[model samples]
Target: MMKMMRVAVFVFLFLGVAAGAARAGWDPKDDEKAQQAVDYIKKNAPALDRFFVHAYGFAVFPDIYKGGLFLLGGAHGQGYVYELNTLVGESTVTQVNVGPQLGGQSFSEIIFFKSKADLDNFKKGNFELTAQATAILIKSGMATNTDYSNGVAVFALPKAGLMADLTVGGQKFSYRSR
Candidate 1:
């Protein structure tokens, strides 16, 4: 029984590691998802341009639903970034282990880039999400305030439906411009 337990433990550990590696691995759709997110930036380009240009930082969060058929909504999963149709960015994927809104919800977020230097940093393909980065869950809006002094821009908008900003995972991340 002892030997059997040891074997099971080893197998579990191996599989767990392998799973994490697979998810972290560069995903093909990641590029497409990143481009899709660019739409938000284009919509708010005037305001976004003032924030960053040539190369800058941006971040995005999409709707994550987790509830009944009619009440579907929740913010769960990771978001990626793209520039000039390239997969050159990643978000600090957050997993809400436990919370009051444990069911399902829908939300989305976007970060913009304005300078070549900052955008280059994002396309570097090795940078990770920073603790100071801010991410706000948006419900609806044409544009929001992106304090450039902080070297980051976080915007939130709703595709549809209503939600609270708190439950929206008010997180902050960076992204580059097109």
Candidate 2:
């Protein structure tokens, strides 16, 4: 059936993109990449400094690859999770969406947990970000007074590429002990 074929092709393309991203410079142990991400965020979103210093925990995904074609799209990235300034674990993110969309992009994302309970829930290996979850785009002079909706605040910085997508998607995160 045409529907089955379309689904098959979508899966193939999604997996290819995910595999390519995994093979790219996405190593969880890349300290330099992690540091660069941190520095970029601090410099561009100074207001987040307060959040960074005060957050019970946070996760930073240095580089995420996203791509889409027609009605299918996905993204993947690896990152480090920290608690009280100490490395706590490694995390991976995967997102899938369906809608009218096309193109590809790369970006960095950070999520801050406002409380110990929130961080604990995220570290439980079943954390997910629904379509309702929103991420602020990092820009110069951006205000940091953003409240933690649902105990979490997210920020994203575009790195490279371009994408035009209007889709419904959510991100799922899996964590592992460091």
Candidate 3:
């Protein structure tokens, strides 16, 4: 019963934070953070530098806050969208998850689009990363033998915290031009 109550309280806190984040508009700080995140990723996962050079575009989320307790979980983040290395817009990601999961974590995520069509699709505000879209965790000295799925490749670098999950979720995104 105590554990269940703690989970309930966590869910409420998560919802409050998510709601507050949804109302946040574009801020220059996001740009700064995004760039820092990109630099960090490049330093840690040098292999991903090739994608920055060749990919048509990408979205970089500097901090994605995710929390899960028992069977309910959610994540939210704000990011910048780029095309050919140029910042074109701002985007937000909200995810809902359900399954066996616990703990909270924060991470940086980048989604690379392989072609114009894929980038356009994301810009049109119709992009959602389904369960089929898996993100490779970028860790130093780790081999990455991954490829784009449906013209997009996702990578994540954990910033802090620990979480264990077997949950299924989809990330929904919204975009606005700068």
Candidate 4:
């Protein structure tokens, strides 16, 4: 009985510590940052305004930090999800790639769902961007020729740093309702 009690206590403490560590990386002002990111996209890539208007929903990540060394690289970011412009939840994205790559960078990203079913799939936790998925880098006149490849259109604006990579990876997302 004592051994079982000790093991249970250890598991509880470990889970608590893990949760705290996860929350530690989040900023109280990230909501504000997400808003800023939306505004930045509006200003920098006015052509994307159409997606904002027509998308069934979207996820905005204010800043994604990414790095690569030799054959392995990964990226992570936290963001907010909106439905018809209404804030509904929070989301996180993590990506891993393997290729001959080097360098690092930070950027803001937004993914726009073309239909309710697409957004619903995202919320249901069944959405993933495969290695073939591509994001349109936001810039003046850049998005004018782009459209949703699948049901969602992804756009990214560089924030800082520089990375040159030829990698094949997938992005996995998790969502939590607010």
* Separate clash counts for every candidate: 31, 0, 0, 0
- The digit string of per-residue lDDT tens for model 3 on 54-166 reads 89999988888998888778888888889989888878888888788899999988999999999999988889987878688888767787888889999988889989999
**Which residues of candidate 1, in runs, are more than 4 Å off?**
1-21, 44-46, 52-55, 64-74, 82-86, 95-104, 113-145, 161-178
Give RMSD to native, each candidate. 8.7, 3.5, 2.9, 8.3
Across residues 29-70, which tens digit of lDDT does each residue of candidate 4 receive?
A: 766766787888788778888889889999998888887766
**In terms of lDDT, which candidate is strongest?**
3
CA lDDT for candidate 1 = 0.46
Question: Over the full model, what C-alpha lDDT does candidate 3 score relative to the true structure?
Answer: 0.84
* TM-score against native, each model: 0.48, 0.85, 0.86, 0.82
* Candidate 2, run of 10 with poorest lDDT: 18-27
Q: Predictions ranked by TM-score, top down?
A: 3, 2, 4, 1
Candidate 2 vs candidate 3: the lDDT winner is: 3
Winner on lDDT (1 vs 2): 2
What candidate 3 gets wrong by more than 4 Å, as runs, is 1-26
